[model samples]
Target: MENKELLKRIYLLVKPHRRRLVIAVVGMVMVAGLTAGQAYMVKPLMDRIFFDQEQALLNILPWAIVLIFLVKGLFYYLYRYMLESAGQRVIRELRKSIFQHIHTQPTSFFHKTTTGELISRIISDVTLIHVAISRALIGLLKDLVQIIALLGVVFYLDWQMALIVFILLPVAFTPIVNFAKKFRKYSVSNQQTVALISNNVHETIAGQRVVKAFGMERYEAKRFSDLSDRLYHIIARDIRLNSLQHPLMEFLGGLAIAAIIWYGGHQVLSGQSTPGTFFAFLAALMMVYEPVKNIGGMNITIQQGLAAAIRVFNLLDTKPEIKDQPGAIILPPFRKAIKFRDVSFSYNQANPTLRNINLTVVAGEVLAIVGPSGGGKTTLVNLIPRFFEVSAGKILLDDHDISEVTQTSLRDQIAIVEQQTILFNDTVKNNIAYGDLDRSEDEIVTVAKAAHAYDFIQELPEGFDTEIGEGGARLSGGQRQRISIARALLKNAPILILDEATSSLDTESEQEVQKALANLMKNRTTLVIAHRLSTIQNADRILVIQEGRIVEEGTHANLLADGNVYRELYNMQFKNSNSEPSNLTP
Candidate 1:
């Protein structure tokens, strides 16, 4: 977010429409030329009225004034319309690039950021930058033309009056520059504070269920209020600073005009300057002052736009923590096995979540990972598709390093059914077909039946076309899980991950889901993360994990016989269930 970097990004934004911008600039110059004619016309008209025969020129005078206005109005519309259109197109393209870049960012970015703040950048800040660029560019061009043309008129009428303009320029500019510098700092602070406030509100509303369950509503409200107050204070401060320049410059402009009139009157009465000539010089001075004032205001707008540009550029400049390697090849279909060689990972580098560990699964085997909460079970499965980069070691897919292959190909070969149901607001068939975009109706139905979702789907009002609410809120937890399973089934990837997929279901629902999962795992390489020991009791091999590393690994029966960690865990769940009375006591 350095100054040079900001300018570079702004340049890139305008580069695509350079030809259009040039045309717009030419239009703006024509507009300025027509506008400058008004100042030039005042001198000739004033001289003809006073010195020449007034009646002879009277009829033509009104016509000339009318023509000047006509030309000015035409050029004004052309310049404003063309330049504004160019700015809108450039901003549209910039916003699209930002959205696409965000999509390409690693999944971890979402975990660390809020959607609301990102949305504000894409919408509000972008619009501000667009307005600033378009208006500032056109205004600067017009001002430059006006300054040149008006200064020529002033010097022609009286060189002494032109000196007053030179003196007034710096007096008007110094305060504006100082105000703009302060406004820039405040504007950036205001944006950051507002982003924080927006994030607080979004997170609170999204997690309202937990807030209510824990009776932490007051705490969340207070947190939101504090951030909101900070935003308010910063914005008010920026407004106060921005408001100062306009009035102070207006006062200064008035003082300069007063000084010019005082000095020019003495010259006119002394016969050193004609009354007509003095009026002509004063008209040019008035014309020049408007651009100077506008330039002063435009400086602040430019600074505000630059502040927003810095934030946008910061996002664009960020490097993803996970990305494909240069010259990486796509992974071919799995035929042999998958291996993790001394893998370790962490959300934060200071604390390790997964330790150095080695595990292998044959092409068509089900390897279950059993662990306590936060034992890295979900984290381990996430690594299979490069959702995160391994911190210490490499993971290989059929002897090729996963990092050496493109993410799209690696992910396309794997499917995941998460514990929480994540369905979009779409028809039942669309949700199931989400895993495979090109899947036909038959393929979708076949996969749904295999995942035990077909019966419930048919019973719904619209059957396969029934609209599910956001996140499948219309469906029961078990039904949502089945839909997720159906999605994985339709994918038909060589590798599958079931992360506590059925752990949240009731006993009867779990039994049915386990059957569906078992059938789906028949000929595919599956990685299971189980919280309920019973769900994975029939896995090909079980790895008992504690903290970050594997503590034990064996078959279910063999581990039970060993009477170690797995045996202890199995007995605990079993004893808890058996401890319940068979009949209720009176």
Candidate 2:
């Protein structure tokens, strides 16, 4: 986007606080007027008190200086405080908007985007804009006003000297413009490098176990250090560009001052101007340089802010791929079977994940899907929740299309326990209660007991209140999986989806978890994606999928009798199990 459009959008954010902004603008005007008033007093103070020996003016000149400064300081504080407060409010809203927008995105959006990149945009980028709004933008307005006020005084005292300074001023800005372009380029590179560093830190910390097991500490450290070094170089180049502005501006300012001094002194000696007028013009001329220099500094901040704004706006403008259709009705409770008629899905459209599949999952029935690694078993179940809309055809729940119903209501009827257990860094009680926030403590404990998680949870330091570290790092794999089962049990949904829930557990843990799963799946319409054939032998029906197509379907005994795809899978797993010595206790 163009800078003008970007600034306009930022200005709209400030519109809600227009009253405070108006007050700040008024305070800036007062500060400018007072600054000019101070320089204007230099003439009467020098000519009347020191040169003319006017005792009347001397009596109150010092008092006048104090009063002028006191008022200027008061308004300076008022405006800065107001602007900063308004800036903070804007940042708060922007953070919330970005966070809420991220939640609206489909699963595909997250699959393509990294966590650290989103974090940098929401936190780091917004902070730079805060500096621009609260300090740079506000400072620009104040300095511009002060420059104009000071210039007016200089012209009134001596027009010839004022014109000389004005002509030299443009020379300083030429270098500032060039530096600003370079500052923007470096600033953008710096933000991107910071995001890469953040992504590295996130990955290393989350996978510290893998890193240590493989003895890659030195390797990871070198990788992180390389990213850090790149960031340092980018910032150093930016600093060099920013530092160049001051000295060059100072040189041009010095030249203007020298010219004024030579020409004005000659006028005084020639009796064309008094010492009072010459010195007052010189004072205002020097004051003008301060605001001009401030404006030059603000240019760097503005450019950096603009770069940050581009990223933030891009995220905000992103449209979510999956959203509720207009006039969509809330889904009622499940009373009939779910039907997938001619359903097909593809992530990239180049390779279809599921092809022309048809199936019916009756209420209160357990239908297990056995498939090879990439046969789209998980993808088929994900479609039920509308995580990714089907590329073609439709899914119907009791004759009503799933997509026609609201997402929240549809998800409310389903519960899931996956291969990799997901738990937050929160108390055990809260994790279980996440499925149903309004679930009573008694209900939570009952479900935990049913899932066989109550024993280990009670052994924790704080029982149910114990804090589980990130992703339940403090808990054993079996313990975490049971907690996940407990969460699903608490939801008490009519539909359940289990994606290899017991596949990752040891013999002892699997038996315990299987008992919990039996209780949880009592009357629900359950869909099972099994990696181990033995676990799903008791399922009411089994479908053997291969290459995104159902190659066989029947009971375990019937499929074995048929001696087809299901029988092959059963024989393969049965042989593998027999090869390994049994760990089961008699």
Candidate 3:
């Protein structure tokens, strides 16, 4: 993305508001013409009032000058208001577009990108762009108009003096172009550093409990200081460049004025130019320099905005890897089995996560998958909903290839409850009835009661209407898990994928959740990513996967009798406690 293309895209975005922009440009032109008119009056004031001693002209000239300023102020307000209004609307749409783009991305996108960086891009980077649109716009457009109008005044008074001024003026601004490249470089570093700071803050806050437990407050503080110091260095470089432009413009403007004074004084003495004309040229030239200074000051802001726009545009260009195929059809209800034929998957394609995996989970059967931490258990479950496309093979849901179905229809039939339960900062009822917002209160209560969550719901201050705070922070671990289970129960999907992460709970809480799990798994085809033996003890069939391959498959007792991978896992789990692995809590 070159800057030209970026600017073109931004122009397209601004096109919808062209009516307001045209009016604003009209107002700006009026203000520019009036600016030159102010310098024009200096000529009459010098020649008529003082030199000719015209008493009658004084009254009209003062009132005319006052009228010019009053009208200029009106146009100034009009243009400022219109430009900002247009800018705000464009930003609103741009921010929303960015958010929607991020949501449409595949799950793997989230795996590779952090929440903090995305937050920084949406908030910090967009704000930089906002400043450029709202502030730099006025500087660039209005200043250019002012420069042209003022140049007309100087040229009208004496083209030779105006030519000399224009020649020196370009020299003053040449350094501005030289420094622009550095401005963008520093700004990009600054935005990235801000993202690092955002990431560090998000981590510290999300893991505050761990930070306290490990007593790493000072360590985290040091890390944050490092990020802040990095931002400071980058910002300092940008500001230094900005400051350098200021003095260079002042020096050049001073040289131009000095040359004008010497030449104009000689012209007036030689009767080639009048004092009034020379003075008016001096005034117009000075006003021209003011807009030049404003432009120079905002140059860094504009360049920084362009840098931020590059990042924003790049993010927008990343189309989602997972989306509906052109001829995809809505999936029918799940009635038979989900079969994986020669299904091999890898996150990066370099190393296989699931290799030549062939399996069938029949409808209404409880299939327990037990494996080492990184043995692809979760990845296997994720493939069913098409969170990631299979690297090589296809998944068939009820004899229909899942890839051939619309993702929304395919996902509608599946309900998932994982180790880290996800709940929004909404009400208890809303969380449970997330997909079915139109569900009645009675229906919500029915699912809540089934998951053993209705009792806790009544205990809260607002009952079913209680705000759970972020990620159910206000609730106990068991309470949150039960609410999560209630949500899945409400979905009433035929297929259920449960992580069975009850190992983190107390004995009593685990029992409560286990009861909820029983209700949730009653008639659904369930896949349990089992970590403990208690979860899979009653499973119809247990699978043992190791290093992306199925090592064994049988009931719990049959696997133990085989005395292979399953038996070794049983020994390792129980060896930590007494002989009773089932009684040993997670």
What tens-digit string does per-residue lDDT give for candidate 2 at 1-586? 9878998999988789888888888888899989998998999988888899999889899999999999999998888888888889889999999999999999999998788899999899999998888778988999999999999999899998889988998888898888888888888899999999999999899999999999999999999999999999999898887788888899899999999999999999999998889889888888888989998999889888889988899999999898899998999899999999999999997999999889998998889999889998999999999999999989999888999999999999989887679999999999999956788999999989977889999999999999999999999988888888889888889999998877767776676667667766778899988877767877888888888888888887799899488877777777756454222111
For model 3, how does the per-residue alpha-carbon lDDT over 498-551 read when each residue is reduced to its tens digit?
876565566666666666676667788988887887656777789898899888
* C-alpha lDDT of all candidate models, in order: 0.83, 0.88, 0.86
Per-residue lDDT tens digits for candidate 1, residues 398-464, read 9999999999999999999986679998999899989566789999988888777888899999999
In the order shown, what is each candidate's alpha-carbon RMSD?
Answer: 3.8, 2.3, 2.7
lDDT of 2 at 412: 95
Prediction-by-prediction clash tally: 0, 0, 0
Worst 10 residues of 1 by lDDT: 577-586
Arranged by lDDT, best first: 2, 3, 1
Alpha-carbon lDDT of model 2:
0.88
